[model samples]
Target: MIELTLIGIGTGNPDHITMQAARAMNAANLILIPRKGEAKSDLVDLRRDICAQVLAATVRIVEFDMPVRDAGGDYAQGVQAWHDAIAAVWREEIARHLPAGGKLALLVWGDPSLYDSTLRIAERLPGVKVSVVAGITSIQALTAAHAIPLNPLAGSVVITTGRRLRAHGWPPGADTVVVMLDGGCAFEALDPAGVSIWWGAYLGMEHQALESGPLARMAPLIAGRRARLRARHGWIMDVYLMRKEPSNG
Candidate 1:
């Protein structure tokens, strides 16, 4: 049986890795790092850097090209097909490297439990014993970087994806919302009058950028900045928190 360990390495910063994650990296017989092509080459480089910093000399590193989803098809169906393709790739790579079966690890960006699909993909590998090493999430980094609590005093916060926010609009009774995986500026769809936004890109990295202000005032600036950064870096990961004015309710 192959022992699969999903180690969360936090955002793009090497220092974000926990001791437990480091230990898992060092102990693994092989580590699989996915190449997301030139557009997101930095992602693969970050995984390599983590291995370089944490893995033992004897630990083997394997690289594989990741499958891209079919953007033309229905969103869910495209994602499902893409995930199956990835599972097939993983199986082939594992069989090629460790024909007899052995311990393997994958360094995940941010915590796997939060908006990550590594666990779901692992489930497709029947009889594979899965282990998880939790690390800081982008949400944690975003909140900490802003020095703000995730929710108002004793209030609840809804964590959601950008698509959901765009489709459903602001959720009912949720004073604060944290949005992730938003390729588009979904916030522009909402009435920005009473809402405030705290946005960050490349959190926990040297190239980190942050902006906070009334949604109406800062929405355009964030959009402009996001476009420029994405053009410059070839890719970008960002998250934002939006809160309605407490007194307005």
Candidate 2:
């Protein structure tokens, strides 16, 4: 059986990797690094850089081209199909490299458990004896970068995606809503009256951009900056936290 370990390597900065993640990376007999063909660059460079810094020189490293997801059709169906394609690739790589059945690892961006599909993909690999090593998440990175608390005193935090936020609007009973995977900056549609926002782009990276304060005041700035950053870098990953003013409630 293949002993599979999914190691979380934090967001972007290599230093965000934890000691546990480092040890997991070093212990793996084989590591898979996925390259996204459509992205501006290999977004998984975190895996390669971490391996260079943490993995033993003799440890085997293999790079594979990741399959692009079909953006057409139903969103759920498209994602499930994409996962199947990814699992097929993973099976092929592991079989070709570790036909003897040994410890294998794949470096995950941020914590695999948070808004990530690595765990779900691992589920498709039957009898692989999967294991996980947690690392810092983009939420943590965003909060840390903004130097702010993620929630109000004795309040609940709801983490969601841009699509959901756009479709459903503000969720009831949520003290703070942290939105991720928001390429369209869905906050634009929100009633910006008493809501406050803290937005950060490329968190934990050298060119990190941050904007905060009243949603009305910061919304346009965040949108402009996001466009500029994406134009400059060809790709961007960002997250934001929004909450209604306590006084307004």
Candidate 3:
């Protein structure tokens, strides 16, 4: 039986890796890392760094080129096709490296339970026993960096993707909203008045940047900063939390 473990490494910080994740890495017989093109080489580098820091014994590390999703096609269909292609690549690599079936691992950016699709991709492989080692999420990292809690006491928080946020307005009955996987600053579509925002980029890494204030005041600033950072680094991963301002009473 093939034991596949998906370990969350957190938001690009070596220290963000938990002890459980470290043990899982060291225990794995092989680890697979994905190369997301030259523009986002930092992602591969970060995974390499994590392996270097955690794997104490000899373990096979295989690097595979990731498939790009077709953006021109229907969104859902494009993503499904892309995932199928990636699964094919994974199967080939696993057969080549561990034909007899052994323990394998993949490092995920954040907790698998979140918006990440590593778990979904793993489902494509048959008869592979899977395990997950949770690590810090970008949300937790962002909230910590800003020194704020996720929600007010007894208040609710909604976690949604940028695509959903743009498609649907502020979720009905949502006390606070946390948006992720947004290439564009989707918050600009909403009325900034009565809303406060806390945003962070490259969160937890050395080049990390943060900005927070009334949404009206910070939306444009964040958009500009996000553009600049992406241009400079060739890629950017960011998250933001927004909530209606407390009643002045």
Best candidate (score: lDDT): 3
lDDT by residue (92-183, candidate 3, tens digit) is: 99999999999999999978889988889989999999999998999999999999999988999999989999999899888899999999
Clashes of 1: 0
Q: What is the C-alpha lDDT of each candidate?
A: 0.93, 0.88, 0.93
Off by over 4 Å in 2: none
lDDT of 2 by residue, 59-123 (tens): 79999988899999899999999999999999999889999999898888888899999999999
Sort the predicted structures by lDDT, highest score first. 3, 1, 2
Query: What is the RMSD of candidate 2?
Result: 1.3
lDDT of 3 at 142: 97
Q: What lDDT would candidate 1 get against the real structure?
A: 0.93
Query: TM-score for all predictions?
Result: 0.98, 0.96, 0.98
211 Cα displacement, candidate 3 (Å): 0.2
